[model samples]
Target: METFLSNLSLGFSVALGLQNLGLAFLGCLVGTLIGVLPGVGPVATIAMLLPITFSLDPTGSLIMLAGIYYGAQYGGSTTAILVNIPGEATSVVTAIDGHEMAKKGRAGAALAVAALGSFFAGSVATLVIAALGAPLTRVALMFGATEYFSLMIMGLVLAVVLAGGSVLKAVAMILVGILLSTVGTDLETGDERMTFGLIFLSDGIDFAVLAMGIFGVAEIMRNLAQPESRDVVRKPIGRLLPNREELRQSWAPVLRGTLMGSILGILPGNGAVLAPFASYAMEKKLAKDPSRFGKGAIEGVAGPESANNAGAQTSFIPLLTLGIPGNAVMALMVGAMTIQGIIPGPQVMTGNPSLFWGMIASMWVGNLMLLVINLPMVGLWVRLLKVPYRLMFPAILAFCCIGIYSINSLPTDVMLIGLFGLVGYLLIKCGFEPAPLLLGFVLGKLMEENMRRALILSRGSLSTFITEPISAGLLIVSAVLLVAAIIPNVRKGRDEMFVE
Candidate 1:
């Protein structure tokens, strides 16, 4: 307890500094704007901004980035509530009831509830992160190469299980990602392996370039292709505050969602993506009038928004502690850290305590900033939504091109965005998600490195993986999970759950 308090105190000292506070505020502002722009998610925004962070201090830059992440959770609800356009995937459930509320002239109240609920969840999740950080890092520190390899295998298995749609497709995307990760020089031998005699290929694909292409440019393309009409609420937003009955109904669901989201967010395989959906399902099941769920039930909006925000904040745990990204957004964060010369892992806490805890503490502050910025600025956000998609698409594409080009002044990087943009579009068309591919790509190099080290230590003995207790246990669990996920009944149930 004493140590936790001491560390938290240290976090506040760093996060509350003038410069760091300003960065947090700026991040929140930018994050909210991007979130309001439908289809421009935090992944693309952060990828675009990575080059800018090169000049900033690591701690401040990370604090700002963390702010953007959770801030988007708050901002994503605005479009969902006012226009039925779900700015982020996490807001899809929010749109069910939120848009209904907007249609019924309760837009203001719904927006307020979402922002406040997100704030409460973010605050709670921050505390959870601080509490879990040291212990999780200690656990991570004990992992040897064999254990780490097995753990990563478990993570990929979890990814396959949790991934929506066909298991086979997800596995194929993951394999492709692993293959992409190998398209560079071998670390030990310093020999180019998969370069195909191209100089650009020799250095491997740039994470930011791939991310910008897959998410940024591709998102622009997808959004441009979609029908542009939106049923934006133009009437006077009713009272911004929830009524007594609404508040009364919301508090319990908010609490439940925060707890559920916090727990799920800690799980591997982008569990945060499941948080809002799970909360919605639970809320519907628990409601006396389940029929009200899709008809503007305040609890639906409040619960899922809270869950989304909480999950976004808590998903940082794996990235901070175990040096593994649980989702695509965190994978971008890993790229950011690597670009900044910080090798992520348990050592981050002991080696860069300020950066670690400060980022955690800044989340609470960022949430507060979002709450303050979102409510009064609701009018601005709604007005911004009136902008034409045609204008937005070109600007986004140009900005992405500029950002990609600036990375190394390589025209090849810009061209790669075009290539990957097509790839991303095809992935969507083929019913495969781009996120799992990105995660696999991020984890591939680490997995291969650890597997090699573990094999070397074992003198080419394949049984060593089973002989090590931790590795054996992890592999067993992973095998069980994979088998369960593949079972006909289990797979059907899983598919149904995600479909909801």
Candidate 2:
């Protein structure tokens, strides 16, 4: 206890420094703006900011980056609620009811719920990180390659549960995502899997390109194809904050979502993405008016919005404590640490308390900073809904192209993005959801690596995956989830979970 207290004190001292505080504010501000912008997610934003972290104190840099991450998520719910366009895949569940509320001219109520819920979640998740950091790292360290493989398998199956369309179509899209992931050079044999002899295929498709093409460019194509007469009601957006009645209905959801988000956020692979959806599903199951879920339940916005923020905040646990990045933003963090000559791993706390604790303290401060920036800026965000599509699309597309090209500096990436844009459009036309495909692609590379590593470690013995304790546990849970996802009776109730 003494040791922990001493470290916490030191962390607080460093984090409260004026420079660190300012950076935290900067990150939150930048993050919110980007989050409100369509297609430019925290991952791409963090990647773009990687070069800028080189000169700062580790505490300040990490705090700012983490701020960007959670802040973007906060802003994401706004767009999801107001415009029906999810700021990122994580906000899809939020859009289900949030946008419905907006359509009903309760955009202000939805925004208030999303923002406040996120703030509460961010606060609780920060505490969760502080309390559970060591134990979670201990749990994570027990996972070997075989266990990781099983975990990835579980995540892939869960992706299907969240697909939200035809099951067959969702599975097909997942397969396509996996195949796309295989386009890069094979690690074991140094041979291409599906590169089609194209030089761009050597590195596979960057997630940014795939995501941008599918969501950003394809969305543009879609809007242009449809007649402009469809958009009739501009959300009236009466008030900026929720009334007392809404506050009463929301507190429980915020708490539940925060707890769920913190736990799920720390899981490897697509856990952070799953946090919001899981929270939304849980909220509906627990709601008094379950039928209001799709139509316009404030709890729907509150829970998922809180979950996404908490998940975003807590995702740093693995990256900071274990050197295992759960997502792209965490990966960039690892890179930033590496650039600073600080190797991130179990020993980081022992070797660099200032960095570790300062980072942790900065997260709490950053979350607070996000609330300050986001609440007042809600008006500015709503104004964005009035921007002309022609200007917005070009700007969004340009940012997407730049982000994709910077990953490998290849023109072929642009072409692949265009191709995926077309594919995404077709998928949209066919009523297939794009999120599960993105999730599948997100897990694909790691899934392949873990599978190969496990096989190699076990000398190609498949039984080793089940024979091990951690691996067996994950596989068993996966089996249970798959069964639940597939069973006909259960499917009728949670049908939203079992499709494309």
Candidate 3:
């Protein structure tokens, strides 16, 4: 307890400095702007801004980058709720019920719930990191190749539950995504498997291109095809805050999601990305009226938004405590720390206690700043709904094109975005969901790499995964989920829950 209190004091002393606070605010502001812009994610934003951070002190540089990371979470939710375009993978779940709420003239309510939930989650996660960071890092380090592979298998099973329609079609989409992931060159061998002789294809498909094409461009196409009166912005804008019933429905989900996210975020290899998806699936399963999901359910919005933010904050645990980068964003942070001549890991906590704790303390302040920024901006975001579709869609197209082109300065990527847009439209027409495909695409390479490593470590013995306790447990759970998915009664229940 003394250590905790002492660390807290040190953290506040440094984080509360005027210069640090200003940097935190700037990061939050810039992060929100990046989030609001379709296809511009924090990874790109941080990479772009990294050189500027070299001029600042280590503590302030980290504080600002941390602020930008979580601030993007808040900003992404705004776009998802208002325009059905998710700026980040974490915001994809929000777009489901959130955009539905917007169509019902409840855009204000959705945005408010997202922002409030994120703030609550961020606050709790910061505390969790402060208290349990070391222990969590130890647990993450214990996960070997076998355990990691099993855990990802379980995650993919959960992704199966994320489907709102035909289970077979969802599974097929995942398989397609796995196939797409194999398009790049073999990591171990220099041979290309599916690039079809195109040099750009050798690096595999860009995630931003896929997301923008499917969600942004395809959505614009769909909206244009619809009658003008069918647009949701034409409806009266509803109240900004949730009512008594909404508050009651969302409270428990928020708490549950925060707990889930805190635990998952500490895992290596982008485990935090799975938090919101897991939260959404859990809320739907636990709901008495599961059928209300994907139709503007308050629980859907509250649970996932909270989980996303919590995961974003807690993902720093591995990096700070073990010097392990959990995702690309953390990888950039590792580079930032290295450039600042600060070595990461347990030694840094002892050697530079102020820098360590100050960054942690800044997370709370940043979350507070995000809340202050987002709530007032709710009115401004809702006003965007009033724009005409004709003008709005072209702007979206321009943004998507610019965002894609900015990634590599390649026109081929722009051409690929259009191609994927057409593909997305076809999939939508066929009643298939693109969300599962995305999950599969993201996890496929990780799963393949880990599984291969596990096999090699065990001398090609298949039983290695089963012999490891943690790996066995995860795979068992995955098997159970698979069996449950195939059972007649469970399938019927799932089908009913997803019925539109």
Highest-lDDT candidate: 1
lDDT order, best first, reads 1, 3, 2
lDDT of 1 by residue, 194-278 (tens): 8889999888999888888888877887887788887888767899999988899999999999999999998877688899999
List lDDT for all candidates, in order.
0.88, 0.75, 0.80
Note each model's CA RMSD in angstroms: 2.9, 5.7, 7.7
lDDT of 1: 0.88
| lDDT string, candidate 3, 79-196, tens digits | 7887777868889999999989988888778887888899999999999989976465457567777887887677667556544567678789878877887888898998998988
> What lDDT tens digits, residue by residue, belong to model 2 across residues 323-425?
6566656656665675566766656776777878887877777777777777777778768655655666676567767766766678977787788889888
TM-scores vs. true structure, each candidate: 0.96, 0.72, 0.63
Stretches of candidate 2 above 4 Å error?
A: 2-27, 34-69, 76-114, 203-216, 222-257, 260-308, 311-360, 489-500
| Model 2 accuracy (lDDT, Cα) | 0.75
| Candidate 1 wrongly placed segments (more than 4 Å) | 489-500
User: Which is superior by TM-score, 1 or 2?
Assistant: 1
